[model samples]
Target: MPKVLDCLVNVHFGEREQPAWMLEVRDKYFKGPQSMYRQVDLAELIDEMDEQGVEKAILMYSIVKPSPTALKFVEEMPDRFALAVNGVDLLHPVSSLRELAALVHDLPVAYTTVGPSFWGDGMYPPTDAVYYPLYYKCAELGLPLCMNTGLPGPPIPGEVQNPIHLDRVCYRFPELKLCMIHGADPWWDVAIRLLIKYENLRLMTSAWSPKRLPDSLLHYMRTRGRDKVIFGSDWPVLPMRRLVPEALALDLPDDVRDNYLYRNAQEFFFGGRSAGGTAE
Candidate 1:
């Protein structure tokens, strides 16, 4: 059986933390209620490790940049964490995609995400030439590239989170492990069908609420290839313990469930660190 892995988690310390307006939206529409994100970050990490019996995580968002935050965990417990480099928010003053590519070139980034963390532009698609090099860099690095599909409300508008927008990139960079996050939310159907058609692409369970997850996602994981699925909680957004039970309870095979939870990521990220050890 595969072990469950808390594939995603983060600690955010910024000048203005979890902005109030976005907080209001998250408080309302995010997977679980505020009750889930109520716990302190480290406490929840320890608690989830105890509750889920899982090992390893991709600790993103140790802000002020990715290297420092990721290094902290990696330096302490090397194999336990896969630190990522932060990509320039499309809305931020991203000088050029070339600059962004160069910034990540020498860093120990397992992979990175292209997103809308800034105030304006959203990473809509690869149609624009700027995103092509970004994809190329990912392919060159051979890292898992996670693209935000759909997480809306203050920060960005709802329309910007669509996954169909990824068509151009997926088509252009066939080898890139472009794992779609959040079931691509409203775009789940498009994403699922696309993955079905294109074997290289994959999906991760980032923020899908069991209560609200569409059946298409269940069918894809159940009927399609479980090996292609990855586990993610969009943590500080949805806790691992809270989300895993719902997924584990599904009718899929135990091994399939395990694969989705951690096995696949273990193989992908650590190349064989699937022994269920978080010890340094």
Candidate 2:
């Protein structure tokens, strides 16, 4: 297997399990077994990662703040894990920015996230001034901002997540490294156009299975988007054991596959280190 670095993983390390509401949503929409939501011991998770050739993974918390369980995972295996903060309250921009700053200040935070549907009841669009402060802070810190850009799995209001909303964001905060996670869905064309228009934006294949990825995105990944895309398992949501092999089996150029698997992520989060090393 080629080197791999999962950009968005929901790790159930320690005593934490995925919240019940989220699991209920997955059970309702997903067609397969709910095995992805099953909790596993940290050591068991590590064994699976090792078995799958995942060099590192960014542990993202699903709620409104960073989870202690994620911190504990990083603390226990600093070389194997990094943190991503999610669900910051855009309603209170100032406090949110401060909390974001504090999280990055005290931890190995790779980036911060905004789940348009999950936060503020899916009312705030990506371009809303409410998200500006967070965007500004991320640009200031040279930190990447990951957002849910497609129709969300949970039945929350999804109009707030249109990929079009990011056009203004990229134009306003040109320096912020923005990553759109989950698939861009119905708006793949718009997402593709915006990615072409913004040097700092990227698309991450996280929750969507590789074979299920839209043809447009696969074409983009194999062609001009080689360096503009990254990989993520959204773990348990799609276990590495299954996700990695499917990704590696894609009919992509070797270089494009390499970039999708790890190289682009290295540049995105680790300043383009050429050697095999963990993401920070």
Candidate 3:
């Protein structure tokens, strides 16, 4: 298998089991889901990555972003990972969003994560005024927006699943590269149409099941023929060992599969940057 760089996995402090929001999410949606995030540590995660041959992973976490986590990985290994930062918590109704923009400047940041599912609690609708400042921060930084567009978490309602709601943000921040995950879930067709229409928008097929690489997703690639799709396996839930092999075994054209597997990510995002830098 080509080296798998899982772009989004979360790791958190084991003792930090009391973040009110997380506890709320656990009570509501994580009814019986394993609490691995609180269980795994760097050594354990690295051993798994080695055993599975996962070359790298970009973390997108709750209390903090992945860039800091990547810094930790690189400090010991110096070349194993990179990250995208998600600044959604800047929504606390102060100059918090703008202040975060300044804080991020000193950090080894990449993109900021947000998704409609995680919007209000999931990806909030792009039309909500609460998100404008965050959008502005994204555009200013030239960092991509890691927008979630997949299965709704239990805490999120059904209405928030549509990816079309992001149209307003796309229109307003044309300069910001929006990386949609899970191919924007059910409204994938709308997402593909948008991708074909705008060069600035991109999507990852990370969580898409091979059995159902939706018609629109396949059609857009076969016809429009762009190499924007990147590999992203929602690791931990779907371990890299399983997800990578399944993706490798898909019935896609060799080139398409390669791009989806590794090329697109190496080109569009990190561009071969060597890892290892702490944010000032």
Candidate 4:
């Protein structure tokens, strides 16, 4: 089996420590006794990754206040994990950027994530000036800015999540690396166009099950966009056993499979350092 790097996994500190929104979302989307939303221990997560053949994963945390435990996990096991800091307060752009800088200055974080649909007023487009500072900071740090570009997990207005808003952001900040999470679904065609247009933008198949991935995305992944797409199991929302197998089972060529499964993420997060093996 090819090595894997799951680009988006959510790890709670513990059962009782999970956020209310998480429980609400779980109740809404996941039903039955076998749902993956049940509390997850860090050790259990590592075990699951090992069982699923995932060599490394990027743990995404809430922007409001990233879990200290999540940070500790990556710190303790740097080789097995990397952090993706989500939800920066764009309302206070300057100070938020400084605070974010301090947070990742010496940590094991690979990128900063923003959910345009859930952050701030929920109406500002991704290209709004409020987000420019954060983008500038990310560019300065050489860290990719990951954005949730489709319907968010929590109950929120989805209009702001449109992939079209990113055109201006990408054009304005050409040097900044952007990772569009969730495949920008429902508008993935627009995403495909953007990916083709921008060298620094990438897309990860987070949140969506592999079987549900659009045919357009699959075609792009196997051909022209091969180097621009990566794998992400939005864990707890989707189980590893289900996600890994389905993704690997796709009718993808060997080169595309290797790139999507790990190489793209390795380069995106670690500047070309493969997490499991030498980069091809």
Candidate 5:
């Protein structure tokens, strides 16, 4: 098996039950039994990753609060896990930047994240000026930014996450490394165009099954877009044990699958780190 680097995995506080909202999401979107959303024991997750040949994973934080437990994982297993700050308040850019700066100063934060549609009633798209400061700060600090794109699974308005909004943001901040997760459905044509147009942008295969990845995306991965795609389980939505094997089973060239599964993420999110977790 190729060494894996999961670009997105939400590891909640160890061994605790998942929140109610997550159960609803699993029921509505994943179509899996309640066990799919069950909380994971961190040690067991590591064993699973090892059994599955996963070298490392990026733990995405909550939308409501960054998990201290998540940070503890990074602190304890610096080589196995990295943190992505996803809970920052987009409406309050200044405070968000402050919190981000503090986290970056002390933690092995791989990147900051935003879910445009999950911003409650504000529903600010990625292009909204409110997010500019975060873009500016992440770029200045050499940190990447990951945002949810396409129609979200929950009941909220999905328009806010349309991939189209990223065009302006990308153009405005060319230095920022930004990734669109959750597979930009419906607007995949637009997503492909943007991925081709922007060198600093990437698409993560999170929240979507490998067998079902769009043909257009698969073709692109096999051709000119290999380096532009990254692997992410968005675990609990899609478990690592199940998702990794399915991904490896795809009819793709070894190099292409390598890029999708780990290499691209090493370069894109890990600052050109080697697969063994050493910086180039």
Candidate 6:
């Protein structure tokens, strides 16, 4: 059996230091009147992964700010944790590129993630010129850039989450590896086309519960697109204990499961290394 690699986990969502706007968004989408948002501590998170047989998890940061605590967590357990940085100020592309270069060079960060929908309707589309420098920097660093697609969890403009915008990006940055987070949901057909069209592009099934995974995505994962789809628990939103087993219980073949669980992500993020180690 292959070890699990959870491609998306958030360690800072419900923390006290998290921004009020984020908490508000969480309350609206993730929490209910009878339920409260619970922040998972580092120890608890590690234990959960251990119990669920997860070999590694990528800890994603908020777009508003990168969490120092997340950096510390990955620093403490470099083998088990990988950081996915956020908050690159696209308005200041030059400085943002420098910061991204430094982060990938100096820290245990595996890559960066962004939600184009968070910037609102008319601003910062994935194809915007503002992201060109960042794409170039990522290609230079040999890091895959992950971005959220499909409907955002919060009540943000869903139009911005369209997978079509990425078409232009893929065309422009052919050398840059891109992971479309959330499997592009309602746009699965377009997402599949993108994956087939662009050798450098892949998809991560994060945020979507296994039971809730779209049939089209399941078909792609089990068949021709096996090597292009990756697994992620989107922790805090969906518990790994539940998500992992649900994914493993799918009708997918063993090899497909192995690739989705770890191998594909391993190659995409870590240069297809046979030896196991955290991203540096």
Best by TM-score: 5
Weakest ten-residue segment in model 5 by summed lDDT: 13-22
- The clash count of every prediction, one per candidate, is 1, 0, 11, 0, 0, 0
lDDT of 6 by residue, 1-280 (tens): 4589988888775565555656775667666332234565789889989888898888886445667667778878887888888888777767677777777777767778777887645356788787888788889889889988998776567777789999999998899999999768789899998998999999998877777877887898877798999888777777898888998888889999889888899888878753146343
What are the lDDT scores of the predictions, listed in order? 0.62, 0.82, 0.63, 0.82, 0.83, 0.80
Candidate 6 stretches greater than 4 Å from native: 17-28, 31-39, 62-64, 120-122, 274-280
Worst 10 residues of 2 by lDDT: 271-280
Task: State in Å the error of residue 69, model 1.
Answer: 5.0
Clashing pairs in model 2, backbone N/Cα/C closer than 3 A = none
TM-score of 6: 0.91
lDDT of 2 by residue, 75-108 (tens): 8988888888876767777776787788788787
Question: Comparing candidate 2 with candidate 6, which one achieves the higher lDDT?
Answer: 2
- Model 2 per-residue lDDT at 230: 88
Q: Which segments of model 3 are wrong by more than 4 Å? A: 13-15, 18-35, 51-53, 62-71, 90-95, 119-124, 271-280
Residues 1-280 of candidate 1: C-alpha lDDT, one tens digit per residue: 2466666665443213555765676766663464543424444566676677666666664223444444555566554555555554443324544554654564434556655323245544445665566576668767777766665545555555576767767787887777776667667788787778766687777766554677777777777767677887766677666777787777777777778887777665554644333322
Which portions of model 4 show Cα errors greater than 4 Å? 13-21, 32-38, 276-280
**Cα deviation of 44 in candidate 4 (Å)?**
1.8
Q: Residue-wise lDDT of candidate 5 within 1-280, one digit each (tens)?
A: 8989987887773446766656678777678776764566779889889987889888876546657667777878888998888777766767767878887888777888888887766367887788888888999999999889989887779998889999999999999999999899988989999999999999998988888888899999998898999999987668888889999999899999998998899998878977445867
CA error at residue 98 for candidate 2, angstroms: 1.7
**Per-residue alpha-carbon lDDT of model 3 for 1-280, expressed as tens digits?**
5566667665543434545655565566544255634545678788878876677676654334234444566456645655565545646834555545654575445556766665555545666887777777677776677777756554456456566776776787888777887667677777877777777777886655554677667656655744877777665544676677777776678878767766666555664553233221
* Count of backbone collisions in candidate 5: 0
* Colliding pairs, model 1: 91-121
- Relative to the true structure, candidate 2 has a C-alpha RMSD (angstroms) of 2.4
Alpha-carbon RMSD to native, per candidate: 4.1, 2.4, 4.3, 2.4, 1.9, 2.6
